[model samples]
Target: MEILTDYILQFGDLNKQQTDLIASKAKKLDLHKDDYFSEAGKIPKQVGFILEGVFRFCYYNNKGEEITNYFVEEGNFVVDYQKFHTQVIASEYIQAVTDCKILAFSRKDWEDILNTIVGWDKIEAKIYQKCMTQAIERRSPLVSEDATTRYLSFMEEFPKLINRIPLSYVASYLGITQQSLSRVRKNIR
Candidate 1:
């Protein structure tokens, strides 16, 4: 709960009453490795904050291959925002890659909090902006950068990700085959 308070304090000050109100609406969840917080085609009811461990956003392509889109580590928020906001079924899945603990708030509860809390709207807007910027940066490299360059950049940005995630998923995100990723690693080593 203190983690939630810390996160809120980053955006604005919350008195004890306000903090308690928000905390009361949040639910704690524990997930095993490979457990899905939200699956494709399901309407996601809650947005989650990672208390521990890692989660990945993924989807299958036409060929039925899973493609990793984003990795949310501890101290981050995990939500399929488009579906959560629109009340539509999500196209992707949010899954735990390691045993995880999370604090989750229902969409309705979040909306209520936003309406009642001063300066919350601005905080939410900044969050959305960061999400969008990350998406743009990811797509830009795939569209314009060569494989080696992309691989190098990925290592520079998230060197630990290669060791943390499965090679297949990392390769998929890099738009390369696992063998290629292996070669890239070898080259770098």
Candidate 2:
């Protein structure tokens, strides 16, 4: 709860009562590796604040190959943001890449906070903007960089996370084949 509240506090100030309200509504969730926190085509029931571990945002491509687009680690929130706001089905999956512990709030509880707490929407907007910025910073380079460059950048940027994750997921996230990733790894070594 402290970790979650600390994260939220970074975006905006919350009085004690408001902070308590959020803490009371939070539910602890534990997800094993490979578990889907939210699935494609399902409406997410809760928005999760990661306390520990990593999650990968992925979807199937036209040829039915799984493609990873983003990785969310601890001290961040995870949800299909657009879908959650509109109460629509998600088009992508948020999957646990490691054994994870999260603090979460149901959609109804989140709405109650938004309705009852002043300035919460502003705080939310700031957090959303931060998430968007981080996403762009992580993803933009992938578009123009060669696969080797992408892999190298991924390593330098996420040294701790890369070792904890499977190379298959790393390859997918880098938009390269496993064989290519292996070749890169070997050549770099």
Candidate 3:
């Protein structure tokens, strides 16, 4: 809770009252490995900040293969932006790749903060911009790089996660087969 409060403080000033309100409404969530934080076809009624562990944002293709779109690590917010803002069911799933501890804010609480806090709009906008920039960075190497290059970039981008998560998930994120990822790792070594 302190970590989350500190993170929010980075974006804007929060008075004692505001901080207490946020802390009061925020709840802790514990998810075991493979548990889903959110799933396709469901509306996510809360926004979560990862205190510990990793989550993957994934979706099934037409052929039903799960493609990992993004990874949310500790200190990051995990929410389906479109679904959260529009009140629609999500098309993607946020799955815990490891046991997770999260600080979650209910939809109503989130709205309350926005309504009551000063400079929240600016804070929100800054957060959105950061998320957008991260998405763009994650997309660029996939389109422009070869398999080995992509794998290398993944290593650079998620050094901690590379060894923590199953290689299959990492392979999927890199758009390569597990066998290929293994070979790439061997070649690099």
Candidate 4:
């Protein structure tokens, strides 16, 4: 797919043979809204790149309430990185929030690609760095900022997501309640 090619190109250039190899290993799958790409306690076998729609990464607490962590939309990668890398059970769940098209490659297949392809190893390293940076950035504000400020910052950073995702999940991600989020929105308006 052009989208997959474009995304890969963002990290590094790929030769025709390398690209064809990758294309052969990558599988396209459609997910319905609320369908899970990966669930807690399962070993994540594949890494997915979102070609369309949105996905939410969440975890359930001891109280059995889902705590939203990350949101990935089109052109973004969505995978349980810890589980995928370590071949262990995932601690969080990844679910599609809307109908989604995803390009998936198994961990072994990706590793094989990296070993054989000239630039693929560097691309994988860069992807890991990007993922780590994003993870840190996402957690930093919560530790350093107050709830209202966090909510405001989220609104500013992801203006479109405010309209796309449910307010409840957004509130959970911001460490606030739906009622509190409503108040914050009203005050800002």
Candidate 5:
């Protein structure tokens, strides 16, 4: 898909042949809301680039309550990076928040690109660093900000997601209760 090729191009140069090799590895998939792209305690088989919709990075607490920590929308890659890289069982879940279209690559296929492409390792590292940096920046506000401020920052940072996803997820991400989120919303307006 053009979307995927364009994204890879942003990180590094690729010839037609290299790009075709990548395209050949991509398997298009559809995931409906509430579907798990990858589940907790299972080894991830493939990594994906979101072509449509949103996904949440979540984990269960000791009491078995699922808490959403991060979200990935269209045009981003979604994976439990450390686990995927080590080929280990993931401790968290990557779940679809809305109907989604994704371009996936199996582990072997991803390794093929790394081995075959001259500068792919560097390119991959850059992409990973960028993703990690963005995650850190998004989370920093939550550590020190109040509930209202956290919600406000969330709205500003992910303006597109505010109306697209369930408010419960927004509440979880903001570290507040749904009732509190509702109160904050009412007070803000």
Candidate 6:
């Protein structure tokens, strides 16, 4: 909760009462490896803040292969805003990459915070902006760069995650096969 408070504080100032309200609304959840936080074809009830471990945003392609869209590590937020805010069923999945501890709050509580707290909308807007920027950074390389270059950029962007996450997931995220990723790694070495 302190980490979440600090993360939010980075974007906007929150009064003690507001911070307390946020902390009160959140609940801790432990997810084991391979557990799904939000699954495909379901409406997500809660927004999760990663307190520990990593998660991947993924979906099955037409070929029935799972494609990793991105990863969320500790000190980050993970919610499919289109589905969560619009109350629609999600087309993608959010799954724990490892055992994870998360702070979750229902959509109702999130709305309550938005309505009750002053300047929260501004803070949320900034958070969404950051999320958008990150999405762009993660996707743009796939369109313009070679697989090896994309892997290099991934290393640069997520230096801490390379060793923590599975290489298969990283290869999927880079739009390359696991063998290709191995070759890239070998070449780099």
TM-score per model over all chains? 0.89, 0.97, 0.96, 0.92, 0.97, 0.96
Ranking the candidates on lDDT from highest down gives: 2, 5, 6, 3, 4, 1
The digit string of per-residue lDDT tens for model 1 on 22-141 reads 898889999998999999999998889889988888999999988888777787788998888889999999999889999999988999888897877887777767777876776577
> Which digits, one per residue and each the tens of the lDDT, describe model 2 over residues 1-75?
888889999999999899999998899999999999999999988899999999999999999999998999999
List the candidate 5 regions with Cα displacement exceeding 4 Å: none
lDDT, candidate 3, 1-189, per-residue tens? 788888888888888898898888888999999999989999988889999999999999999998998898999888887798789999999999999999888889988988988788789778877877897898787887999899888888888998789888988988889999999999999
lDDT (Cα atoms) of all candidates against the true structure = 0.83, 0.93, 0.89, 0.86, 0.92, 0.92
Query: Relative to the unseen true structure, what is the C-alpha lDDT of residue 33 in candidate 1, on a scale of 0 to 100?
Result: 89
lDDT of 6 by residue, 1-189 (tens): 889999999999999999999999999999999899999999988888999999999999999999999898999888887799889999999999999999998999999999999889899889988987998877887778898899999999889999989999999999999999999999999
Could you give me the TM-score of model 6 versus the true structure? 0.96
Steric clash pairs (candidate 6): none
Query: Deviation in angstroms for 15 in model 2?
Result: 1.2
TM-score of 5: 0.97
lDDT (10s digit) by residue, model 4, range 1-189: 778777788789888888889888889999999999999989998899899898999998899988998888888788987778779999999999889999999888889887889878788778778877886787678767877898888877677788888888899888788899899888878
Mark the regions of model 1 whose C-alpha exceeds 4 Å error after superposition.
Answer: none
User: What is the alpha-carbon lDDT of model 4 when measured against the actual structure?
Assistant: 0.86
Error of 6 at 143 (Å): 1.8
- Model 3 misplaced regions, further than 4 Å: none
Cα error, residue 156 of model 3, in Å, equals 0.9
